[model samples]
Target: MADKQLMTYEVGEQMNLMALLKNVTVRVAKNGKQYLDLTFEDQSGEISGKFWDASAADIDRFQAGRVVRLAGKRETYQGSPQVRIAGLRLANADEPHQPGDFVVHAPMKASDMEEQINQVVFEITNQVWNRIVRFLLAKHRKAFFSYPAAKHNHHAFEGGLAFHTLSILRLAHSVVQQYSSIDAPLLYAGAILHDLGKVIELSGPVSTQYTVEGNLLGHISIVDGEIVSACNELKFDLNSENVVLLRHMILAHHGLMEYGSPVRPRLLEAEVLHQLDELDASIMMMTTAVEKTSPGEFGERLFAMDGRSFYRPNEPQAGGPAVK
Candidate 1:
């Protein structure tokens, strides 16, 4: 994309713009001067800049999640676009915009997403699975619907955790219908609860960061423990086949040990859950990349996709969807 149409700029020129401080960090320069590494974002996208010789007060005021009025010039450094900060200050209360006006949000409304996912909950037919899913959903209701699935990755915006889950649920429904031997209830429950641990693993949506427990134990372990606790609280037999199978779905959803799964999926449903989980996340990441890529060119490298960049076609391709 052209630097003029870059992310937040409404005009095709460098000028003062209201941008959200997506991230801010203090660093020591080689000259022993303190500087601020800043990331600014709007509904469109993000740009990083540096504020050299930052005061302690500047560090305190230019925090993540705050809206700022900034004058920056779009510049290229080492083959990547960067913002050269001229001046910036926190947006005043009298300003028309606020923090939320610049933050990226899920395409779907939170209430609508909630209602649609609730409809999928009905498809979970197994009584044991149904009970645990409902209980856990209720327990982490707000965060599950509001938190991003990860600090940075596919679906890393507001309500992303729920949106990503819903996408998997939709894909799983088609898979179950196509393959009758597949346990519909098991797959549905697994999709709904697969990343619910993110509510505890990641902090709230804005300027997200991992918690101490999230860093040490990770979401996979955190959620497995949650399932075990839920079973105990529900007075359900923790050793029962149903509980074991349900837990296995979450436990092995990451697929392999290296990816974070404690055990490889031995059951058919568990295997399907892992595949669909990966599929939904991959699609979201690619979709976002394709949207940004200019015609007949490759987008930026996706670290999650093994540092690969996808090509955007100038004309409609015969076999696939076109970049929008």
Candidate 2:
């Protein structure tokens, strides 16, 4: 029988892990034999794995979105971590965990995030923007709190969409405090609506992927279209100054055209929104990478950060538990 006790993944150590098959593909090795290339994810993080010389039944047994117990030896190839699978099996019904147990989740509960976001919606004093935001928020409330912000990278977990918006809101408040010239209501409204289109862009939390609309139009365009629709539905002029400014914030949140923003931030509030959004996302991505790294060493390279690998400083904080 295969080992039931799961252990941590460390190079030169045998790993007995219960993980979600986050991604699975049947590929050919150099010898022309088939192999199962897999991504195994647990509460801790994810790692690449391969079941070499896969059989017909092996292909049938392993699949993405399935929970499995894996027995493998962790090793490095070309400086990247990978597991060479020796034994693997589908998780039994009687196992203590399930697929949901493996996918990552935001720190805040969905209910809490929704409640707090609802309050922030009211904080948007511009009645037109407030009405548009309320209409859209109500329309996509379920997916807003349930979808991940991205298919991967920072905040690619359950409730991450809402959590990420909330994080930006928190940052926006501080920015407003620091710079009195910034319009609080405009910034808040932009923060709320910035990534709301992701609900349409991404399929959902589990095995997240881009939807057809997402691939064709992208989130920025999708949300801008939504705003136009909401204006027509609510009898607000789509070309009005405030509506145009709000749309600019959404379209310019990416900060640059190459990154997908159709326009650069032209308003003061729009600029602040762009910077705050970038700040929160950068911090989240780096933090996620650091948490997965061993203390005193650098983490995997961040493709989002120009392929730079951040060093996980070995020194413990003044009050927190030391990183191990």
Off by over 4 Å in 1: 1-12, 28-34, 75-81, 315-324
Q: Extract clashing residue pairs from model 1.
A: none
Question: Taking the tens digit of each residue's C-alpha lDDT, what string does model 1 give over 152-242?
Answer: 7699888999999988988988998899999899989888988998998988888888998898989988888888888888989998999
Worst 10 residues of 1 by lDDT: 2-11
Question: What lDDT tens digits, residue by residue, belong to model 2 across residues 42-154?
Answer: 66667888888999998998988888878888886544467888889998888735778788778889999999988988889999999999999989999999888998788
After the best TM-score superposition of candidate 2, give how far the Cα of residue 134 lies from its true spot, in angstroms.
1.0
* TM-score versus the correct structure, for each prediction: 0.89, 0.89
